[model samples]
Target: MRVLMVSWEFPPVVVGGLGRHVHALSRELAAAGHDVVVLSRAPAGTDADTHPSSDGTVDGVRVLRVAEDPPHLEFGTDMVAWTLAMGHGLLRHALTSLLPGWRPDVVHAHDWLVAHPAIALADVLGVPLVATLHATEAGRHSGWLPGPLNRQVHSTEWWLAQRADEVITCSSAMRAEVSALHDLDAGAIHVVHNGIDLRRWRSRATAPAPAGTGPRLVYFGRLEYEKGVQDLIAALPRIRRRHPGTRLLVAGTGTQQEMLGTRVAEHRVRRSVEFLGHLPDAELTALLRAADAVVLPSRYEPFGIVALEAAAVGATLVASTAGGLGEVVRDGETGLGFEPGDVPGIADAVDRALSDPRAARRRARAARARLRTDFAWPTIAARTAEIYAAARPGPPQNLPRPKIPTGNLFDRTP
Candidate 1:
């Protein structure tokens, strides 16, 4: 089977997990004897050997970086313009035979950023379009499109869903949310859990807690309000009361870092919490391995890729039952769960893990085993390939270029 994947993020220029997700999935698909081609934005000063102007292959998968020229426009306007520019690049590539005897059977898109090119190319090629909604603007904004930017993003997401032949989400929770928001049939959406490379972790030696150090509670992710890191901060004093020697490690940096720092100072738990901003992979893995329990108190999570990483590193999880994190961390089974933004609940969960290290270790072991077998990349790749195979081709009708709405967000007259 031949596959065409469109995404804005890729290797050496990853903004978040989406880039790594595409890189891993494409490589696995290529390894499985399927022809895979990726169309992604080429970052400035991209290495010529790895990311060429016309064509290149990364781990046996062909990758073409669509060059984008900077336009003198507002940030939002430039974003939309760049998206359409990348779409035009894809159009030229599709019309010409750059690769010998290679045509896409399916076009898989990652997010709304690449919707224009992916939908148009799929329609022109008469192939099925499969789109994975990693996260939705509605979900991110707490179940509402609050402003013009939010509404514009939500509109594009809805439009992309309508154009795609099949839609894929990272978890069942996300599928339900998408269905409720878009009024789509529940059966039409498929859930594919995020995966990780365990071998990279298995080779590392588990970092042990420093001599006489207290139980370490680690929170590693974007330090945003929706990420619920503040809830963890608020819960720290209580957690310390239960275990006086408890220490907290806040990893990763975001817009809320300054506010979070202020909260730590106001709470007067400055000595107990260490804000380690942006750790290297080695340091991150070591922290995970050394952590007594990892806390994820996300107010909204389409899927918690970091939860999987913590679990794979044999770290116990005390996560909120928000969106897809619930699917990943079962309450009292794989890991412990609490209500989102419940400071008391987060404190209680952390206390339980610290008090019962033996049980927490058992749960972490169970989680690691599950990740290795159930959420492995090869397994995930095979499942995604099956979805591609199952996607029926659409009519060979060349679609007109998608026009950005000028008035209403949904392109409908009010």
Candidate 2:
């Protein structure tokens, strides 16, 4: 099967797990004798005027990276306009370069960011449109469209879900969330968990960091409110009380870094915590292998790909029972679990892991064993291919395009 994947992020331009997910899936699909092409944006800071777009091949998969339109639009300030510009660039590139001689049997969209271009391309090609809802806007806000931006994003997600021939989610929890938020039938959504490439995440030959006086815990991911990193900071004092000299290493960056720093000061655990912003894969894997426990305190995770990465490196996990984390980290079986935003619960789980190091290693080993069968990229790719085969391609429907409302009011009409 020929597959065309439309994603806003790809390798070297990844914001989060969505890029990694698409990258791995595309490579695996290509390996399985499928012609795969990814339409994504070029790396940040590329001059769009000089290099409008470029094509390259990575790991046997063809990639077409488009540059943002040369406009005075900023993503942080004008998200909707920036996205529309991106869509326009992608659509123009596809019609002119990609679709003349070559066409895909199906078009797969990664998230709402690429919804416009994906929908337009699929409609023009008369191919099946498969959309993967990595995470929903409503889920991130705890089911409330609080602002105009949030409402607009929600409407775009709903439009994509309604227009898709098949809807794929990373976890069963996300499937239910997308269905409820978009008013789609639960039976129509497919739960396809994010996959990991164990080879890439394998621990290096270098010796792990020497054990310190106290337990060393690591939390790697975006430093956002929804990631619940603040809760992890809140639990630091309690964790230190039980296990003195305990240190927390925070990896990754986001909008909440300054606020998390304030919380660390308020807790007076500044000395015990270190913020290591965005380590490369090699450095991060070494850090995870060295840690006593990897803590994931997510409040609204669609799928915890970090958990899979930590497991691959044989690091014991201490995660919250939030969304996909609960499904990924089984208490006592895979690793330890706590309720979302439960500072005390997080402290307790960490203390337990630190107290019983042998047991934690045993569970870490179990998690590593589970990855080969459960989260393997080839298996995930095969399942996704089945969904593609099941999708029926026909004439495009005259569906309403999602309109980004300028004001508070939204057009709720179907």
Candidate 3:
């Protein structure tokens, strides 16, 4: 089977977890004896997209990168619009004009950023399209959004999901949300769950979860509002009352870092909290392993890839039960769960993991076993490949190229 995947992000030049996910899936698909190609947006000099500028290959998977020339677009001057236009042009130029002769059976796209190109290319090439909705606006909003913009984003999401021949989401909870929110048929949405490369992660876990000589509790991911970083911050003072020297390691960066820093200062748990900022994969795995427990207090999540990573690193987890995190981290068996906004609940769960070494070990074992078996790359790759084959009927039709404009090659208003 020939597979073409479109994603806004890919590894080595990652903006978030999406990049790693796309990269992992593509490599896995290649390993499964399929011709896999990934279409992503990257800087011209980025490692995944070296000198040739337009297209390249990594680990047997063809990667096409469109260097976003921000100054070129004639549309809205807003940053978001410019980004959307850049991505749209990249897809049109790469798929329709530059890579005309190239066609594949499956067009697998991840998230809305790649929607315009994936949908258009699938139609132009007469290929089936599969969509992976990593997260939704509602999920990201944590039930706060209201009015026109929210509705517009929601409607766009539904249209994109409806366009796909198959829908793949990261968690069982996400599947349910898609079915309910987007009016998708229950049979159409499948739960693949995000996977981690255990060999890379577990090896780094040799550092152990940082338990301040005894046990460490960690909350590592993007430092932002929707991420519930505030709740985690609030929980710290209460937690310190129970267990002094119970250090909290907060990893990753975001727009709210300064604001979060202010909150951390207010609590003055500054000494108790270790703001490690952004950690590389090796460092992250080591941190997760060094800690007694891992925590993701997201108000909403499509799937907690970090939770999967923590589990892979053999760390017990305490996560918000709002989204797919609940599905992956079993409440009592693998990890503990807490209400989304409940600071005390989250704090208590963290404290439990810190104090109960035996229970934490058991949870770690359960999490590790589950991640190794169900969410391993090979298993996930096989499942995704099956979706690709199911969506792709056969050889693509010999499609005619769009008449490129004398000026901008990506002008596809027709």
Which candidate number would show the highest TM-score if scored against the true structure?
Answer: 2
For candidate 3, what is the lDDT?
Answer: 0.76
Cα lDDT computed for each candidate against the true fold: 0.83, 0.88, 0.76
User: Model 1: how large is the Cα RMSD against the reference?
Assistant: 4.2
lDDT string, candidate 1, 1-414, tens digits = 989998888887687889989999999999999999988866743433544466789999988876554443333456666566666666666557443567788999999988888887887778899999999887776765666677677777887877788999999988987776665787999999889987666637555455446788899998878899888989999988888888888889888999999999989988888888998787889988888899999999999999899987888999999999998998888899999989999999988888898999888888888887878999999999999989996664444433443333322311
Worst 10 residues of 2 by lDDT: 405-414
Off by more than 4 A, model 2: 203-212, 399-414
Error of 1 at 21 (Å): 1.2
Native-to-model Cα distance after best TM-score fit, residue 195 in candidate 2, in Å: 0.7
Query: What does each candidate score in C-alpha RMSD?
Result: 4.2, 3.2, 7.7
> After TM-score superposition, what is the CA distance of residue 348 in candidate 1 from its true location, in Å?
0.4
* Candidate 1 weakest lDDT stretch, 10 residues: 405-414
1-414, model 2: which lDDT tens digit per residue?
999999999988888888989999999999999999999987545557866689899999999999877777777899999899889988898888888978899999999999999999988888999999999887787666778889889888988899899999988888878776777888889999898888898647553564467788999999889999999999999888888889999999999999999999999988888899998788898999989899999998988989999999999999998898899999999999999989999999999999998999999999999999999999999999999999986566766755543422213322
TM-score of each: 0.90, 0.94, 0.86
Assess candidate 1 and give its lDDT: 0.83
